[model samples]
Target: MLKVAIVGYGGIAKGPHTSAWKKIENAKVVAACDIRPERLDLAKSAFSSNIGLYEDYKEMIDKEKPDIVDICTPNYLHSPIAVYALEKGAHVICEKPDAISVEDALKMQAAKEASGKVLMTIRNNRYSAGSQYLKHLVTSGQAGEIYSGRCGWIRKRGIPGKGGWFTTKAQSGGGPLIDLGVHMIDLAIYLMGNPKAVSVTGNTYSKFADNTEKADSSHATFGQAKEDGIYDVEDLAMGFVKFDNGSCLQIEFSWASNIKRETRFVQLRGTKKGLEFRDGIIDVFDGGRNTKRARIKHNVDARKLDTGIAKVLNGHEANIRHFVDVITKGVEPVFTIEQGVDMIKILSGIYESAQTGKEVLL
Candidate 1:
């Protein structure tokens, strides 16, 4: 059996990670690490009473020597922890955004290469049935050469874990752009054949947290910032990225916006046909007339959706199952280190553009 340890006992770790691990036969989470004793207690309560818990991940890795490390920490902590785990002779499965910056992502990639260990990011959307179907259709030439696409995830009031790392730029990077947008952007770029980004122009806004007066408290999970907490990140971010293949993508995301409710969209135009994923449903249309349509439904638990993040569905179970395949069968993962680095590069450019008010050249 592949011995596994989970770093950070946060919500995702306790919810999705635990659920996913229970389904895998060859992998077992024997250890957990968290700075918060309360969270460690929660982890023990959810899993086994005999599971090992450590306040520091380094000590945990050094002592337990787990074969796999599941990193479910905040954005900024992802790279350093993952690189350390990889160097300790363990394959790593990291949560999304991979890392906060391109530099860190490259460093993690180099470490993974040096260690000869697998490093996979949890881009759960890729494992979703809708995404799988889209990939099959596009790869099979149903959607020919792509031109441009639009993707966005917006909400009226959905800031989660308010005063925590989620709202802090240093910890969580920007805001919805890095959090929710990363998934949509990844899906867009993936469907578009992972085109290389050449340039990006973007903008960001912070309207909700600053002025709770304008925020819809009715739907708000917006938390109070701790004395040391911060709300420096943007509430919304929008950008246009041009690819080396001459195609362009328009993307946007907002943790809290002026929209009616939560909304999501992804549309692509190709030579032969067009594809779209709107509000969790995938659709295909004839490119010429744009009239003929086919809708594909994914097996999503609609009634059990996480209201805090309604735009995107969680595919944690499927993502972990794929990781199991990679570890047990030595198969290639769906997303590569290069792609993970590329994601950071694009997101970094978008943030730079947002700050400098100039199109950033990738």
Candidate 2:
């Protein structure tokens, strides 16, 4: 059995990790760590009756000596905690936005190389039935030669609670761009066969954050809004990316917007065929007057497919199971550290472009 340690006892830890871990065989949560004592105690009380708990994750890593370390911490701590875990001879599964900066991401990559341990980022979108089928079509030339694509997560009003690490750039890196846009960007690039990014042009806005009344409306789950705390992150971000192969991508993300629908959509246009996944439906359009809609059935329970939270946990379990299978069978995991680093590089370029108001040549 592969022993595991879960670091971070937040909503994700309780909702996704705990739920998904129960489904995996030969894997057990031996310990859990969090900075918050109450959160740690809560995790211990709810998830595992006999699991060890600690305020310092490093302590947990040293004592548990787990085969895998699942990091569900805030964005900024991803690299440090992951590197530390890897250095201590544990495979690492870090939640997405792998690191805040490209340098940190590279450092994590280096650590993985040196440690020779599996390092996987939790990008659950890649595991969706819709995504998997779309990727197969794209790779099989059903999408033909792609020229352009657009992907976005548009929220009418969905800011997370204020005053948390999420709102602080020092803690969460950036705002909606790093938080939500990263997923679509990763999915888009992956479906595009990990294209070489050549340049990026982008913009950011925080107009909605200034209005306190709009904060509650923007947040989908509002635990508590600290009216006195600082909100310095972007509420919205948009970027245009050009690849070395002449393909282009237009991306947008928002915590608050005036859009009519709350859409999480990706549209890909190819020379011979076009594809779109909008509002959970996947459609294919061919140039020869052919159109087909791909029906997606939830292999798992409907309750298991709600938020990214559920998806991430389920995805993490699958990812870790695959990692273990690869390790035991002498193969490589589907998602590698190099791919994770590439994602970080692309996101960093987008943020740089938005800041400079110029096309960042990568």
All candidates: CA RMSD (Å): 4.8, 3.9
State the lDDT of candidate 1 residue by residue for 208-247, as single tens digits: 6665544453324432345445788899999999999999
RMSD of 2: 3.9
For each candidate in the order shown, give its overall lDDT on alpha carbons.
Answer: 0.83, 0.79
* Residues 172-206 of candidate 2: C-alpha lDDT, one tens digit per residue: 88888888877888888877877888888888988
TM-scores of the candidates are: 0.90, 0.91
What C-alpha lDDT, on a 0 to 100 scale, does residue 361 get in candidate 1? Answer: 97
Runs in model 1 deviating more than 4 A are 213-228, 287-314
Worst 10 residues of 2 by lDDT: 302-311
Q: Candidate 2, which segments miss by more than 4 Å at Cα?
A: 214-219, 222-224, 288-290, 298-316
